[model samples]
Each structure stands twice: as C-alpha cells, then as structure tokens.
Target: MLDAHAWVCCDARMIQATATIRCAACILFLNGCAAPATSHDESRTASSASSPDNLSAATAIAHTRPLFDVMTFSQWQVVGGDARFELHALANPQESAAELTLVGRGPIPRNGFLVSPRELGDFTLTVDVRIGSAENPRAEAMNSGIQIRSRRMNVGQGNAAQWTIGGLQIEIDPSSRAWSGGVYEECGRAWLASLAENEAASAAFVLGGWNRYEIECIGPRIRTKVNGVAAAQWFDATVAGVLAFQVHGGASCEVAFKTPMLIEHGIHEWRALADEVSGSSGERCAWQSTIASTTRGVRLEIEGAARVDLLADDGARLASLSTSPEPKISAENKAKPSIVELLWMEGEGAALLDGVRVAQFACVTVPSRVRVLGESCAVLRAESLQRK
Candidate 1:
C-alpha cells in the first residue's frame, strides 16, 4: 500500500510538470506571433505622410529647411547673372530660420530657380515674395513666380505648352500692378486671369513687404491667392510638366517656393469669381457614357454660373441638364462611394477649379467601370448594405 501511494504522488507531480511546460510554450508562441503585428503597425504609422492626395496642400518655408530637403543649392541653376546676388546667412538655419537673399544692383541680376523632383500633373505653389520698392521708386522690385509643368525653352525663355513659357506668373510687382497676383502667359499667350479693376481690393498691397502668394493647380484647374485673399482661378488641362521662377528683364523679383504640395482628387476649387457666374437652368453635369446612367443619375455639386451638360461617348447629347447644383446618387453596388461623391460634397465650398472659367469645382471621383465626359464625375457606394 505504501509503494502504491508513493507511485500515485509521483504520477500527479509528473502531470503537473507537463501542464506547466505546455502553458509556457503556448505563451512564448503567442508573444512571437504578436511581434510581427506590432512591427507592421509601426511601419504603417510612419508612412502616413506619404499619401498622394496629401501633397496638394503641401507647403515648405522659403528660408527654412525641412527635415527632408528636396531643394538643395546643387539642384538650382541661374541665368543672366554674374555673381550679382549674394547668398546671405542672416537667419540661422538650425536656430531660427534660413533665408537666401538676393542683394545687388545690376542691369540683369542672377535669378533663382528650382527643378522639381519629377514632372507633376497638378499642383499648388506658395511662397513669400518681398520687394525693395522703397529703395528705388522706378525699381521693378520683384517680378517672379512659381513655374509648373513647364519645359525648359532656352536659357531664360521656354514654352510652357499650356500657354507661354511661364505657365502661371505670380505677379511680384511693387510698382503699377502692386500686389496683384495675375496670370500672364510668358512669351506665347496673354490672358489676364484677373483684371486690374476687378483686383483692386487684392491690389491694396503694401510695397517693400513680405506678402504670401498661393497658386493651386489640379489636372486643368488653377487658382491663386494673394495675402490670403482670392486673386484668380482658371481651368486648363493643357500640359503636365516642370516648375520655375522668372525675374523679368528690368523687374527685380525675389520669390521663394515652399515645398511643392499637391491635392490629387478634387481638382476644382472656388474663386471670388464663382459668385459672379451663372448655373444651368435645369442642367446637371453628366458623368457617364450610357443614357441609362446619365438620365437617372445624381447631380454633383455645381458652383458659380456653371451650366450642366450631358454627353455620350461620341460627345453627343444624352441626358437633360440638371439645374440642381448639388445632387447625390446611390451606387448600384454595396461598396463605398468614390471621388465623385467626396468632391460633390467638398468641392462645393471651393472658390477655384483648374486654370479657367469653370463654374464647377474640381476633383470628383468616378467609378472604375464608368467613363465621364463632362467637366467632372465621381463614383459612390452605400455605407451599409441596401437594395438599389
């Protein structure tokens, strides 16, 4: 009996040890499995700033260097200068701010220009431009701009292909066009996005001061702002290219571009001119090629005096124009709605779209299976499972 009791106690001890070992091995396996998931989550968190849509609103400081330096001295080249402008270091790059100054008086001063990393389709450029108009009353203080999607023509003159070489010039003037940020087609075309009389309020600029200028471009839509007020907006999907700044012959302009930022989806924006336009009587913007999809479809957000028109694949008329400026359509599938839905909602608030006189806002998402013919189109899906 004593031997049996001892054997029973040993058996119980062995069973307990086995159970403990199994629990330890299970815990170790779970921890190892969880390690990979944790690493993946961290990686995704770090890459959150790399989205394409986020680039639309991206900006960089003129005098400061960002953590990521895409614009370096080596990346810049000059024309018509003989060491005229001195690269000053008044502001400490590491301490306060870094500024590159053009300090000289000559017939044709050296101009500053930056080459983009890659060719951009649509973008908005912003920079702080100041002129020394106070020093010389006749001095063309600053006449430069943030050039985009532009091909290098000659040393100083290139053809933008969209209009002139300087696709869009942020007028840096302290003389006649004071603070007016108007669009001037370089050597080829001459169309003023802003009239002198219309831009009076914005032209109330202070000479010899740092004023902010923002130029927005998406697909074909373009808008510009001066000192936070609306200047000009237009639509022109002509060229997808490079960027530069031009300091015209006698006009001494010193302009700096913050980081080149972009917004991918909603190309259309709003301008003050939108309030002065007209919309269709009962016309809705068409998005699809099929008559069935066009007629009984939703009306996206319309701005200003934009009239809607429906078109077939062959550019033929299809559905009647939706007079409704804002319309929402439900998709046939259970998936979420597309860019069209987002823009139809968000674009309504924009004051500018592309680079022309478009009453409709930009950046509408379309269904992958569908084709749009009008100014814009977008795809949408229901949030919950619902019968169409």
Candidate 2:
C-alpha cells in the first residue's frame, strides 16, 4: 500500500505569483514514488546545471535545489514557468482508469497558458501532483498529468487529446483504457494503440496518488515505468529531445520537481534507409533535416501521392512539402508537375506551391537548432522515415 498524508491550511484562494513551500518527502517522492526517507548521512546528488531559469507566475510553486545537493546544474531547466499548485474539486468521479483529484487554481487561467518548453527523448521527469486544497474539508477529486515531449497550442484545443504536440504523454486520468503512465504521441499518434500488454505490476502501481513517472529513451525504444512498474513500452526511432508537464485547466493541482536531472548519452547506431521515399503513395520515404552552409532545410522524398505537412514545435503551422503530377505521362504526352514545398518563418509563415498552384503547394522555413517532425496520415501508406 502507499503511505501518504493530507492537511488543509488556508481556505483563501491561492495567489498567482506566490511560491510554494518545499518538502523533503516530496523530493524523495519524485526520485521514486515509493522511496523511503533519506538519512542525514546519506550524501545527496547534485542538481542539473542546465535546468531552466526564469520562472513564470504558474511555476512559482515548483521546487528547486542548490548545486551542491545535486549533479550538473546544466542538466535540467524549467521548460516553461514554475509549476503552481491549487485546488479545484475535492473528489471527482472515479472512472475505470484512475480517479481525478487536485485541481490547480490561480494565474493558471482557464486556457492558453503554456507551462514549459518542448521535451523529447530519454528523460526521468517526475512531479508531485495532488487533487485537494489544504483548507477544504473535502474537495472534488481532480485529474492532472506530466506531459513528456509536449508542445502547447491555442485555447480552442484545451480539452482535445490531439492538441498536444508530439512525444510520449503519461496520462493522469481515470479511464477504462488506463492511459495513465502510458506513452502517447499527442495529436500525432493514436490512443494507447502501441503500448505493451499483460503487465499486471505496471497497471497496478498507477492506481493511486502521487505516483512517480519515469521515461527511458534509447534509440527507437521508449520504456515508461510508474512506481517501479513498467506501465508502457513504445518502439519508434522518430522521437527525440526535451519534456513537459500538464495542469488540466479549472482543476486544482500542484506540480513540483526536485533535483531534476538530464544526462546525455552517446549516439546509438542503427540501420540507414537507402531512399527516403517509397512508391507513388509517399508512404515509405523518410524525413531528413539537413544543414547546407547556414540554411536549414527539412526534406521528405516519398513515392506515390505524398501529402505532407510541417508544423512548429508549438503547434503552429509552418509548411507542407509533398510531391505531385506525380511523375506520369498524359494522353497528349504533356509534362508532369514537380514536388510541393511550404515555407514559414517567425511571425510570418507561408506555403509555396512552386510551379504547382497555391492551393496544392506550400512551404515553411525550419529555424536553426529548432526541432521539426514529418507527419503522414494512415491514408498515406506504410513507408519508413528513419532519423539519425
């Protein structure tokens, strides 16, 4: 069974810019949900040096540590603002997956407030999220999440599962699917369709409060464990980069990160594809990001009727690159058309049709050092776009 405690302090609404108190147990809770208390003699590891600076109003409640207690300060940074804690309901309806509790209040507006930066690939990100307020007698249970490899968008998509950008999301809600601690590619991938099955321990561990969430990324394989139970495992070479957290709007929740760490490993070797394209369908060809001199370009060369769209890490539209006319001969022996390219820049975004019309063509410029991904719908075919 899990060991925990609860208490209500102030009944007044939490201030938006106020910072939260630090608790040692909350730190151990992040290390590993079931972790025992540490002794005074036990030496503490240093924190990441690269952890994000510049806290925002929301994240003011997030925890921080000195360099001496942890490892590289350069390791982890607050992706967005400081995580804030608030109360929404005391106990919400318990569903098939997990119960909802702890709603976040204040400065955490109803919508459109991004908490952090983009997160992708290999991370052991942990947060302490709860459902009640210190002062309430009994509040409705709330639901929250620790978003991994997440990208935020506009207000309209607040409740949508797809509005979330790419990367794995450890869902924190109670549903029959038990999506909690499972790896989900937001807006891009399907729901719990690619997860591992028959893991009783993993499923059982995720049923309670303040559970620890851990994500391990090596090459295309991703493993997620909740409280030491392997809840989900996903194998896809297409993902890489930072991490994030999700504070469901209108719900009361507080997120805290203690001794956050980011460690980089040497590149892993893998098979290289011969052609980036498959057939006429643009199903098999892969996407590539190349740097020519100072200009950065993202290319997709696929076979068949290839329909491609490029999007910024923040869910903003950039450009769509696709091939057409599709390389064929007409009855009159006329020439076919060329491929399509879309370009977009900061503030200004455009789609270029090239010789093709504006409707069929577009282009978006990929900024230097920014991460970009290529997406193809199920209608496109099963072509492999491998990234190195």
Candidate 3:
C-alpha cells in the first residue's frame, strides 16, 4: 500500500512539470509574434498618420526647412510707405509664439510693404493675420494683403519717383466690401479675382481676431483660402517673384502676422541628355530632359514640332507623344509659341497643348527621365527632385 501511494505522488509531480514546460513555450511564442516596434517603424507610423494629402506628405518629409527665421527681421526689407515693424510676443491666449507687428505711423505716402529679398516660384505659404486688436477693434478699417510673385518698380517721374512693390496681391479687406483673400494685381491690372462672386469666402475674415490664410502657387495656377474656406483661384502668366506684406495706403492701421511658413516647390531646369554623351547621338541628340521626381507636372514652351518621351531608369521608354498646336489655332497661329505640359503619376499621364488636353495614356513607371526632342524649344522646366 505504501509503494502504491509513493507511485501516485510521483505521477502527479511528472504531470505538473510537463504542464509548466508547455506554458513557458506558449508564452515564448506569443512574445515572438507581438514584438515591439523599432525606431524606423515608429517613424513610418508617425509619417503615415500626419500625411493626409500630397501637400501634407511633402511638408512632412521633403521640405522641413523654414522660409525665414521668425525671431529676426534680417531676411526682409521694408519697401514703400512710412511704416514700422517690430517682433513682439503675442498677447492672445490661443498663441504662444511671437508675432511680427506692422504699424502704419500716420497718413503718409503710397502703399507700404515689408518685402522678402528671396524670390520664390512654386510654393505653399501659410500665415496667421490680424488686422486689429481687442484694445482697438476699429483700427481705421485696416487694409492689408500678402503679396506674392511681386517686384519693385519706380513709379512717377524725377523727384516724384518712388520705389513701389507691384505684382499679385492677396487682398485683406476688413471693410464692408469684404474682399479678403481676393487676388489683386498691384500697380498693374487691378482685381484679377474678387470675392464678389464668393459669399462664403467673403465672410471668412474675422474682424478683431486672427485669421489663417493659406496660399499655393504651382505653375500658372494660384489658389487661396481664408480661415480654411476656399477664397480665390486664378491662372496667370506670372511665374516667379518676391513675397511681401502690404499695409494699404490712406489707412493708419495696425496689423499683425504670425507663424509665416513656406514650403518651396523648387524649379528645375532641363539638361540635354545627348550632350552628356560623346559625339552626336543621332535623333536622340535633340532631346532635352530633366531627371526629377516631380509630383506636379512638366512645362515646355515649344515653337515647332516636338516629341516628348518618358523613359524608365533602364532606358526603357514608358510613353511617347507628339506635340502640335491646339485645334483652335489657325495655320498662321501654329508658328507662334505654344505651351505644352505633361502631368503624370504612376498609372496615368496626360499631355496638354496650350492648356488643352491632347493625349492620355497608361504609364507603368514613374519617369526616370523626361526627354524632349525638338528644335528651338524655348523652355523645359520641372519640379525639383525630392529624395528621402
């Protein structure tokens, strides 16, 4: 009976030991399946969370450099009118950063501008602006704007001549007209785009508080938003110029601009691929191309017949198209300069002649080279290549 009892006790101990080993193995397997993320995985997860659109993705990954240092005014120069600018800590509870304040001294001369010396072509810009403060809500109905693709010009004659900034101005009207976010051609054609037709945009501006303005310029298209509402969009011939802040003349008002950020979509000049080789490369020698990773498009100014070829990295031609004048063009008009553009993604591509679509095709690869075969082509331009 004692031997039988001892054997039962030994059997129970063996079963307990086997159960312990199986439990340990299960825990090890579970740990291997649910491992912790590495730093690279964490970064990718963060990037994916923040990028909601192409612009956001570009802002997140490619262009992380600021346009200017907000703490100093060294990168900017004051042009026209009598106004003073000072960087001060914002008193608003919603914001903690310093704001650049522009105070029009008194009723003086022409329009005053705080201009940037650096010129930009295609870019996205955002700024927080306030025309008046709570201390002084009615500040002479201050009129102001963010100027882009602008230039300095000499107006009047002799001693009357004064250097004034003139170009595309995004209107900031706090008056009854409520033309805030409208596109105005300063010192040139006036009111290229107005909010008279857009009621939602006209009501976007806050009278005594801060308003956020977002502006984008790509190729010939210009778009604007006021306080998150679509304000204006216009296509123009203006390509590149300086940026400025305008304090409209005839109004002694105070304005504030804070957190001005810009992401530049750099312009790339085309290079002749055939010139890279030794002797003449036959018909391919006429080809001028830009090896860039462009998400936007390519622009070409062609005067005669031309062929554009999109090539892969292995010199495999992805797609090719012949350019011609638009259907509306007469025989005589064909001799004139025509604008041709190619916009493409991984799966689709389209060719535009004089802003009208001429051809569409399936594209399998993102072009490694964009070559153009033509004689007397005026311009070949593309967005700068962005690499992570």
Worst 10 residues of 1 by lDDT: 23-32
Candidate 1 structure quality by residue, lDDT tens digits, 201-273: 3565556666677776654446777778787755443325555555444554433333233342222222111
Q: After superposition, how far is residue 282 of candidate 3 from its true place, in Å?
A: 32
What's model 2's TM-score? 0.41
lDDT values of the candidates? Answer: 0.37, 0.35, 0.59
The sequence of per-residue lDDT tens digits that candidate 2 reaches over residues 287-379 is 333222222223223333554555444534454544553555568897444333332222233333332224322224443321212244222
Best candidate per TM-score, number? 3
Number of backbone-clashing residue pairs for each candidate, in the order shown: 59, 89, 0
TM-score of 3: 0.54
Off by over 4 Å in 3: 1-61, 64-67, 70-72, 91-106, 134-136, 268-388
> What RMSD does each model have against the real structure?
22.6, 16.7, 23.2
For each candidate, give its TM-score against the true structure.
0.46, 0.41, 0.54
Tens digits of per-residue lDDT, candidate 3, 58-120, equal: 322146334444212443555677555544433444322222233333243568776664566
TM-score, cand. 1 vs. native:
0.46
Q: Which regions of candidate 1 fall more than 4 Å away from where they truly are?
A: 1-68, 79-86, 93-106, 109-118, 133-142, 155-165, 251-388
Error of 1 at 307 (Å): 15
